[model samples]
Target: MPSLEVIDEHIVLDILSSTVRLVGSLLPNNIEVVLHDLRNPECSVVEISSPSITGRKKGDSVISGARRDPAFANLMEFSSEPITYVLNYETQDNAGNPLRSSSAIYRNAQGMPFAALCINADYQQIDKAIALIQQLTASELNPTFKKEQQVIISEPTPDNIDALLQEIIDIAMEQNPGSNRPAIKKANLVAVQRMQERGIFIIKGGVEKAAKALGVSRYTVYNYLDELKAQNEGE
Candidate 1:
């Protein structure tokens, strides 16, 4: 079988290709969708529509601004959990026309983030209408906005079992924020609970990996999983 990385890359490409068309058709021409393949940063933008508005065309290199986004490092670092999406964000084109934007980030099975699908819609007319309405109502609502980039979005794709298990353990422990044994055991339970929720145990030898990462016997992981099941059923 192919590594999950290959499978994930193919799936992500198919998703972006189809989703881009769907979004473009459902929205006005003012809305543009651009897909970037991060591995090929020199020509990062693999697919794009409404090039005239955003000034980005297929085969264009990574934009200077996007090259600076901190989340881009998450592809390699894997320490920070990137957000799924951020809505109602503001940004601008080089010419200073305001833009309302959103984005989704995608990763491979190895937890290597690889692509992004971004939507940028011009908001000049919308801003003008809002200003008029605000003036008419004299409301206290603040219409002030600031420029920002879209958030990164990706599901956790566990590549190496060890790395994936360690990440889950970290997430579980971090939830309550402590290092005590009771805290750690509770976190271990939570970690086991989350692993089951996300189907991490479906992979071959996942139980062994979880046991090693949690510093518990395989029987203990099973007990935690059973405990989680009982708790869920009782609730």
Candidate 2:
């Protein structure tokens, strides 16, 4: 008998492609499945199932949907494992309908991400149906049956990588505002710390973009990161 062998990346991707189709067919039609080739960001999507949910097709970029999510992008950096994932995040479709999303990153033997699997499930219709049922069955005197609906919507995907970086920098600056010189230095340090936590510095040119945004040199950003590491270790 032959033992299981480590297959090549292409073969693994092919298997995932079939899995995508099978999973999509078995799941509710509102759920979408997609396989992304991380090496080719420009045309990352290699397979898609139930495209109606998000309208994603083959040869599409992963810049949209869960890929732009900061938590999803930074999962690999926070985890030492070769496989990492983020789940049950809130997102929206192109038409602004609410969706529950999840994503997993697949790495090659070298621990570099080569592909990603993403799922988006639209439950807007289901919510509407539930609301109607509640309205119909609820007693006129009992107020407890009429529950308020709360939906959490994630930020929309940026148009490009530059836009994503800019948004991250803007958010960091907003969180650490300053006016005076000393306050500004502390603000910059806090801003860099926030950016690093969100994995902004992981991408190429991220340090340069952040430095420009924070009005500091690239070396200053590096110093900030080192200081942050030291502080974390001290704690």
Candidate 3:
């Protein structure tokens, strides 16, 4: 297994950038290598090779995809599974080309993912070639050809960071148990804890957004965080 322990987030980027260059040179033109800084979902694409494959360049934001992708969400939540990478998954590019994809996650000493190296291979041409070869040979078409996985890659960047934060807060409130109850303190605490687990607080202005969603001051949000920290330590 590849070593995943990096001293900090910047070093993780350095390691992934080197990988992008080395792998990019060897891979075919249809394959693209992209490195993401997970700590900053907005403008997370720090490096990319064969950018034309996805129409995503450096400084592209993938917050929408990050929110939707279970692999990314699990990494942020520090899931207990021993997963270091997600392989052979499928997604589509901006132009709707079929992409067979895999992602390798890089983590810090504490096992929190700070970076990801993704390889996206556009295989539409290969599919067409296979079909043509079969037809030319007079072979019967395979009855069970795999269908497209249909993962849509939307526009990377949102209109603004605030919009993304608000969306996250709304999801947290809706999903967490205590958040729906009548007790305001319990509801707010649950909301804050949900945000914490999803790693919202890692982003700039995250605390303020949580405070606004809970109808409290930022300091109150801090207190909630401190309380959550104590609870974790106690456990």
Candidate 4:
């Protein structure tokens, strides 16, 4: 793992905490922010609030009581991956009514995951809102979910570019399965052109930086360029 400066840690924590608060505020429920020390998995820092119900106590730590609960124990285990889990529908609040909760995990630069943001949305209200939206729009509510792909990019080896480009092409195809061959080709061309325009293939830049810019692997970038060169020759 790379050594992260204190400033970097602070920046990451701030961004994540702010994002959780913003999303929570927009929804009709309470939100909880939990920070874990990935380096020391036993320690957890938690914050929660609900203005409509709790008022002015949004940053209070209500998690102290639930920290040792089985639900929380399961949450710690779930933090091992970058995933969102809908824990259970039977979990109850202080009033003894059922509750639903969702959680998402985030990782840091060294690929060490250290935090989770758990949201307790008003399931009844949200369901009603969704139904209302669908009725207002006169359309069935069908949401599309995309799987996130992992593209690994090490320091550029001889095979990096070829691999990266192929992955990009694959993702484009997967995203638009009904797209014609010409459309797929055009999309891949756009991807390659964008990378070039961003100067990712520059001789001195780090592989990770190039990969991030292209939203693919450094290997993918290398592969795409190689394929582009071959296609141009064939033309």
State TM-scores per candidate. Answer: 0.45, 0.57, 0.53, 0.34
Tens digits of per-residue lDDT for model 2 on 59-94? 765655433356556754533355788899876565
C-alpha lDDT of candidate 2 relative to the true structure: 0.71
Clashes found in each candidate (C-alpha, N, C closer than 3 A): 0, 0, 0, 9
Residues 150-176, candidate 3, lDDT per residue (tens digit)? Answer: 555554434445665566556555655
RMSD of 3: 8.9
Off by over 4 Å in 2: 1-8, 41-43, 50-104, 119-128, 139-154, 171-235
Cα lDDT tens digits for candidate 1, 38-113: 6765456777777655666667654422212333332334423332444546665545566777666665665555
- CA RMSD of each candidate after superposition: 13.5, 6.1, 8.9, 18.3
lDDT of each: 0.63, 0.71, 0.67, 0.46
Name the 10 consecutive residues with the lowest summed lDDT in model 3.
63-72
* Model 4: residues with Cα > 4 Å off, grouped in runs: 1-8, 29-59, 62-71, 78-90, 107-113, 124-235
| Model 4: pairs clashing at backbone N, Cα or C within 3 Å | 160-219, 161-222, 161-223, 162-222, 162-223, 164-219, 164-220, 165-220, 165-224
C-alpha positional error of residue 51 in candidate 2 after TM-score superposition, expressed in Å: 6.2
Candidate 2 versus the native: TM-score?
Answer: 0.57
Candidates 1 and 2, the one with greater TM-score: 2
lDDT by residue for model 4 (113-192), tens: 45555554335556667866666565333345333444533222112444444554465556545567666556655666
Residue 119, candidate 4: alpha-carbon lDDT: 50
**Candidate order by decreasing TM-score:** 2, 3, 1, 4
Candidate 2 vs 4: which has more TM-score: 2
Q: Write the number of the candidate with greater TM-score, choosing between 1 and 4.
A: 1
Best by TM-score: 2
